[model samples]
Target: MDRLILADTERREIKALLNVSMDIDLNETKDFELSVHRSAWDDTYQYGGYIFKPGTEIGGRIGRLNTDTALETVKVCGLTWRGMLNRKVIEPPAGQDYRRISGELHEVMKELIEPEFEGLFLVSEADTGVTVKNHKFERYTDLLSGIIKMLKSVKYKLRITYQEESQRAGYVLVEAVPIIDYSSQIELSSDSGLDFQLNDIRNGYNHMIVAGKGELAERNVFHLYAWPDGSIRKTPYYTGIDERVYVYENTSTETEEVEEKAREEFAELMNRQEFTMNTSDLQMEVGIGDILGGRDYLTGVYMAKPVENIIYTTDAYGTMNVEYQLEGED
Candidate 1:
């Protein structure tokens, strides 16, 4: 647990006396509190350094503030700096209001981000640095929505940490590659495994028709995994399963590799994977996009990542009770 240390706006002087609590929730927004007891400007004791008021914005060595302060019963219910990303509306200069622009993910991040957010980290080397389509970022669209809509087979996350000396509060933007496997960087804690259920699996698909305008061959077939490592060695389809003949648009191509890759990526995501676990235990460091590998006595082994987190804290401090959805597909 980080000692509750608060600094002024100029990054100087820690607050005097107080009991404090904080929570670092993944995939969701959470708030922390600073408990200060004040009694009529006591000259007997040293006081009057940091004033905890509305929009008092304090955080340096300890952490940053997420939202402004809210007065409660002897506690200021201020939000902690957990990489809160609100929708930012940007309007370009006149004439260049909206033009079809194309750039790699890093270029977009460097230009739009990095300026306001100093603690930004990125996996820019992933997937040969990510390329987006030539699409116009509408003036009113948010930053994340514009980039996500421009690219395919990609996911991004903002990670916040207050765990080190210089890294008092660090925010990172993590992005996965186009044809990537996150099994290396993230895995579910086997010992932390609990009850889980998988839905939308074993859908029947003989052929996937990936269609777009002006394409001759946009058809792809599924593959069966056969290995000495005891993998599913047969076709993962059945007539009774009801799902068949998937049609994916905007990714249509005559090239076999392009079509197959798009179909496979979308297929795995749209079908065969969505795992949610109910556990009383979630590590303090376990983040939003961090992968966890788990196995059940009935369902074998699976790879999962948390998407949405719901947390409830009892005391002003201590580990929070959290319920998060750990899905199999990224």
Candidate 2:
């Protein structure tokens, strides 16, 4: 089993923890829990400490602790992103009007995030081949949440590299990268004796009506349709089939902005295939934000979906188990 080390806020090694488990998701912050005998509890194991899984970039911050006197055990709950990254809001820079900064993804990161983290975290030079123009950061928006939303808008994901034993030890490096596409390289099938659940959206919405800032007669509204050819249409299309309408409300007053937002919302509601699999025995070489292909011969269902979440656990005997939740159609 990989060693789970507990460290102080300064990244100084404290001790190894036992029976630690983690549930990490692409759309949400990582969650972890570790249980120790009551006798092992001490002041050093306080909240705000760091949790590191050596040999990997896994790191989390201790957030909560609970003691069960009857069971004689102390349970520790931790949150990833060093705890504060997920909770800290992107405040407007001093002397600036608002937190509206826009450019390429890397530029935005350098301008907005680097200084906030300074020596504690570094931004990578890797280019995700994505650009954002006129992107506005609202007040009270958490740093990680805002970045994640922006990356998802451009079909990318945020990757944080944690350093364990270097001059940069305890610091996290952030980068935006395209989701790994393993559809062509790896495929899981019934032939491999692997079991998975397949979910198809056959009765999902195909049309959207979006209302933008305005009241009654002055309101700007847009219509969008998800065509079979994978294009969005403002005119009526895809007839004969039942029209499932989805209504979206946006705060934007600009015509182009509202229409683009409507298209995005409609596209999100389009039919897609989802898959879930427990990969403990298979040891699948796929992680979050990676596209994984799967085929079920009995039902003739084949799909390549993006892994949205993973639950990983390591037992006392060092046996590790993994499960994945795959989402998105393309």
RMSD of each: 10.0, 4.0
Clashing pairs in 2: none
Q: Which residue runs of candidate 1 sit more than 4 Å off their true CA positions? A: 16-18, 23-27, 30-72, 78-84, 90-107, 114-139, 144-156, 161-193, 200-272, 279-285, 301-303, 307-330
The prediction achieving the highest lDDT against the true structure is: 2
The C-alpha local distance difference test score for the whole of candidate 2 amounts to 0.70
lDDT of 2 at 278: 49
Per-residue lDDT for 1-330 in model 1, tens only?
223444443323344434443333332344444443343122222222122211211221223223223543244443333323333443455787563555676666455544544443333434446555565665556554454444433554433333223535322334433422344554444455555555535443443444544536533433443222323323444344453555555444434345434555454634345666654565543444445445554556464544444344334443335555554423
Encode model 2's per-residue lDDT on 246-307: one tens digit a residue.
Answer: 88898753554577557767766787667776455566566567777788878888877777
Q: What TM-score would each prediction reach against the true structure? A: 0.48, 0.80
The models' CA-based lDDT, in order, is 0.42, 0.70
At residue 2, what lDDT does model 2 achieve?
71
Provide the lDDT at 83 for model 2: 46
